[model samples]
Target: MSLSIGLVVHASRRGVFEEAVEPVSGVSLKWVTYGHERDIRPHVQSLVDGHALDGLLVGAVPYRACRDVLPRTLPVAVTRNSALDLALALGQAQARGWQAVPVSIDTFDHEVVCEVTESLHLDRTRVTCLPYADDQSVDEICAFHRRSLHDGDGYVITARTAVLRQSRGDLRVLNGSPTPSSIRSELRELLLRIRSERAGAAGFAAGVFCVSRHGCPGDPERSRMDLLHLLRATPELTDAWIENRGRRGVVVLGRRTLFERLSRDWLVAPVLDRAQESLNVPVSAGFGVGSSARTSVVLAERAAVRAESENRPCGYLMEDSGLVLGPIGPGGLGGPGGPGGRSAGQWTGPPTARPHREQGDRMRELARTVGLSPATLSRLAAIEHDVAGRAVTPSELADAMAVTDPSGRRLVRKLHAHGLVTSEGWAQTHRKGRPTGLYRLAIVAALTGSADGHALETV
Candidate 1:
């Protein structure tokens, strides 16, 4: 089926997006105009109420304003300003003998502006940067622009279309014009996410579980009813059906996407975990994904067995190939790992020894959070150790991982997707080709039992 997307843009910027969607097939764009950038939530809501949109593409200003207000489950993409954008505007001004001019920017990252200036080899001190915070009023923004002008600043740049209208002086609206290629790229990325979600919804997943009634004894029938009640508490399990609820175990069938959501631990676990605590019992769940019902059920049973062997209160997943993954179920004990698990008979990672200690357990937990395999976690650990407290060049990472440049780039991109790494900056060996990307691990600092009283790690 063709996907229908809604493009929420300012009235003035609609032409570029209209042109970008002309060449693409199997997708349609509905351009919805908003009078002001901040007043976009209502317009988007109206579009959603009237049309069955598969996704949304919005301008940068409106996207930031409406991000927290709109439903996050709805797929949305926003345009971004590139270094080239700044250079283009600056290049035009430079031709007229304009130099040492203060520039004002709104709705763009300050760090990015600095990086762009440094990358282009522009004199940093000559241009005084004025960036707008989200809470700044229109009047305040205009006042700053006026002050810059009164102070003998040569130029004023802004992303908001309305800001330019308020200025009496000939102010340059830093259009940060959305290129056709960039808009197409954002649309393609959103489409891929939508397709993945749809596939997960259609796929099958099974859960085999047993309620432990050790200290607090209760009737078998009552326990079964309680378990059913707990499962019903979560809306994700609404479509789930109980296959069996006998003395052997309880088996439930549902969409694999629901399993993935519940497996996140923070999402649907608290309801079940809290119920178990109140009932003075423990629940173990084994989740399985497979092509056929019989396969899923068998894998679920094996996963339950694995959970029991590990002495875990939560459940596990047993791959068809006899590999075990998880401590997934209740009480926040969920995690991800399975070194032997192969997808389509391919080795996703090189073999490594499983960690049994605290650091190893922590690494495995972080890996699960980001949906990476245990093998990748091991590789990350090695790379982090090799370059302690330093960023790794893309070429260095590619060499260390023993993969081609493209494969290495994909791996780094995945890490960035999970916010475990970021582009530190760009570096130039000689002013020849494009500058290489310098990447540094993004550390999440939390209180730990370390001697320094803080442990820095990537999740």
Candidate 2:
């Protein structure tokens, strides 16, 4: 779609502006004329709502006039009585042989007038600057211009359209306006920012890690707790959880920016190495990327299993396209047993070996532990794959999981009791309505002696 741009111009100067510039090539312009610069904000906002403008170009509006009223989120460009514009007005005076004539300028500091005079090699005493405070009115500005014309030379310049309307004969008025080039530059920058933000918001990634604590024979429980803390402390992992009774590993969700860091080997490998070094454990983590949360977590589980079977301190990445890559090992292993031994970065074997449980048995066990129906847990597991590590409102959960809102709320509360999720806070949608509660998923439910688990809770 072509960018929609709104222009707020003084009603008197609109004609001159229309004559100077034709329609911009790639944008649709919606113009709103205002009697005063300070009053332009409401009209500009109206244009924004009416036309859905992507950017705004405010003409001859002083920075002081609209700074408080302008929308902070929208890309806004305002015309000011800048230093260059002061030079333009001075040049006009010099052109008319008004070098000896006393010049009057509105909305300019006396210091600036002195600088302009110095640059023009004119006597500073011959120039008069009238700087108006935010409280000054258009009538007061016109009165200053009128007095200057009557008491001194007629050469005058102003930013206010009120003074321009009163100009006649030798009382020349030059409206301090932003050049076409400046407006174009601002628009270009705004478009660049918009494009960058859209690209970042395209998609996000989530990974479920199944860690085997076999290598750490010394205080394995402490190591497991430390691993959990490490996962939570890392800034890159948006959300992290142990997801099981025995703390097999953590499930991590990352936004697009963090996923990009993972692609660069800056996030994942360093984290794995840190966990290995800190916990004195050989870490095997699986990472997956998919369009939905369920797909990503499932793929990540497969990768973790692959890493475990290989007995290496490595990571496997499963792409959304179902392509599996690598028993990719960490770069360095400076753990308890040195680089060459099993404790360095390689898993020797499971310390306390137990009989493996099948998926059906694991599900039944998890359902019993959480005190929820197997079918409900199964439904939750299916929904977990699609969560993508996001916090959800009751309505959002209902829509995504194909349940009633009340049912979703009840299910989440049950999962909370099982230590799978927690209440984050409330988000207010409107001023008059009740606030919606936000819940973050804390853990997934994994059955004893099995890698198989169900999605528990989500933010």
Candidate 3:
């Protein structure tokens, strides 16, 4: 099936995206254009409500304006101005007899500006860059340019069209917008991610839903039947093949996609709440995906055993790839930490049992030194362990910690302040915007007393 992708762009930049996407097989584009950032939310919301989108493509402005409305499951790519775009803009400025030095640039990262200026042999100290922030208003950006120009900045460069309009033709402004190639690259990548997810969703899946045996007043068989009836009545499971498993369990066979929807991408499962309420007993569920039905069933049984061991109404998912996610019941999609807490669904390898007394004391000491809770320090240590000394961006850290992007950035900054992490470099994970800053976590080293001799690093 051809994937349906929604393209959200400013009216001025609509042609750029349209021209770049051109025509591609197995993909259909739906354009949603807006004249201003404020108009983006309504248009994007309408697009999402009116059509079933396989993915979405948007620039940073549109993305920032409507990010809250974007469906969590839908794949989205946010295009931003790249270093190449800035270099091109600088080339244009030079052609127009403008000096590259003593220039004010907006929306690009400080590192990118320095890299471009240093490479071109321009004085880096003469360049003023205001990095993009989601909460920054266009007025604030325009004010920055105005102040720079007033203070002897020779020219102004910006990625935002609104900033240009507000310039009122008085400022020597150069548009450093993303080129067509950048948009096309992001579009193609988003398509690839969507297709990959769809293909993986078709894999075989088996689920075991067990009624807890402790603290229940009814016959085990009756409770099992009640659980079975609940599964049978679930509208989302209508297509699945469900049957009795063991003495107090029900087994369900279905596609991975069906289970993903029920569990909200393994974040939480609301059906467990319904089962517990209906059967008047704790209900635990385990879902597994594998190469074959038997393999999936065995994994599901093992996951169910883990969930049952919790002795509460909770759920877990086990994939043949050795990823485990769990404690997903009645938590309102917050996973283990419940909204802003450490995300329980994040797979940081096999669950680490609680640390021994000596290890716990060391962790507590490190936490005290860093002014963070021991529990938070332990989670960071686990993430560090999983990455095995590899660098990660704030977005990746946020995903692993199950927090918002802004929160992840803040956590990184805090860790950087306390010497628990060191800036490695910048990475262009996406085709647009500024390259994300990457950092290597030293929490493990700090906890194990290995960072005593090294000087704290900075980006």
Stretches of model 2 off by over 4 angstroms after superposition: 15-25, 35-42, 60-72, 109-114, 146-150, 167-170, 192-459
lDDT string for model 1 (1-459, tens) is: 899888887777778777777787888777778887656887777777888888788765676566665553566665655445666766766776766356665544444466567767766565544443446677788777766666655676565677767763556545545567777776777777677656645778788776654433676556766767667666777878874557636788887767767655212244335545555455666777666677888778776666556443466654442234454435332223432222353212111111112333454444433434445655665466567647776667789879876556556655654446666876775677545567875532211233222232221
Best by TM-score: 3
How do the residues 357-448 of candidate 3 rate in per-residue lDDT, one tens digit apiece?
A: 23444554454334354556667777787788799998899999899876687677557645678878779888964567899998866655
Residue pairs with clashing backbones, model 1 = none
State how far residue 361 of model 1 sits from its true place (Å): 23
| Models ranked on lDDT | 3, 1, 2
What TM-score does model 1 achieve against the real structure?
0.54
| RMSD (CA, Å), each prediction | 12.2, 23.7, 12.7
Could you give me the TM-score of model 3 versus the true structure? 0.57
Better structure of 2 and 3 per TM-score:
3
- Candidate 2 at 105: error in angstroms? 0.9
Residue 212 displacement in candidate 3 (angstroms) = 12
Worst 10 residues of 2 by lDDT: 348-357
